[model samples]
Target: MTAIAVGLVCLLVLGLGLVVHVFGRVFEGDTRPTLTNDIVVGTWRGADDCTFTFNADGTFVARNVPVSLFNPPGTTAPADVARGEWELTAAIEDPGGRLATVQLGFETVGEQGQVGIHFSTRLRSNTVDGEPVLYWFNGDPDLNRRFILEKD
Candidate 1:
């Protein structure tokens, strides 16, 4: 009888522990760093000699960017350089503004005097080695492969 009561108590404790663990993860706050104009108005560099220069006036220059960035799956020839405008905004709908994103609008001029094609990419802000860095998913975000840019 005593062993039965102890077993039941153990089961109850285990059940409560499971609920706490699940709820803790579900309700955890966003820990990513927030981006601001002052933090982003500078230069950032990534692998393959990719560089992003952000200006105070919201203008930007990107050079040596991988074709994958301009076109997903990256089958086309690489764009050597591009000029564009940039904007920063919250990454989520949180009123506290915990996470932020930098959106780059690329203005690519087509061949033979054709009109320019406009596309945009978004980078989320994070901290690495206690320094702010910008990054975006290289492929499926669930795969956890990131193309990160560090301040220069």
Candidate 2:
């Protein structure tokens, strides 16, 4: 129609094309990140002097766990060793398959022969300085401890 209208229309089309090109490039290049359970099934030591061994049999052993998880603040309990079972319940990932957070189901038996299942912890599979690490939450809410375990 009019020259001015034609110019405006052309500009709009160019802008739209540019946006589409950029978005297409974003989607075209590796949208999904790779995630594996390769190094996740192993033993790792926590910074709090705890040892967690995740076995292929879906069982796990935690030694020297902090007593604050069950006891009140400033209350110390005896040796904290827990035998439990773990399952890769859920894994949330980004569009690239990179793990955002992993959900692990942990069930431990208390000394009184009571079984407790904890589902509040979250794990992140990552590497620090080229060393593989499995990071997870530990300790009580007040303590707010984070455990980073290296494959042993």
Instruction: For model 2, name the residue pairs that clash.
Output: 32-96, 33-96, 33-97
RMSD of 2: 6.6
Model 2: residues with Cα > 4 Å off, grouped in runs: 1-37, 67-79, 89-93, 96-102, 111-115, 118-120, 137-145
Candidate 1 displacement at residue 113 in angstroms: 11
On a 0 to 1 TM-score scale, where does candidate 1 land against the true structure? 0.75
- Please write out the lDDT profile of model 2 over residues 81-118, one tens digit for every residue: 56666555334535444553435445664544366645
Runs with alpha carbons beyond 4 Å of true place in candidate 1: 1-16, 23-30, 72-75, 93-96, 109-115
lDDT of each: 0.79, 0.59
- In model 1, residue pairs whose N, Cα or C atoms come closer than 3 Å (at least 3 residues apart or on different chains), thus clashing, are none
The whole-model C-alpha lDDT of candidate 1 against the native structure comes to: 0.79
lDDT of 1 by residue, 60-137 (tens): 877777766766554476566777799987776557766488988888633332436678888887777778888888
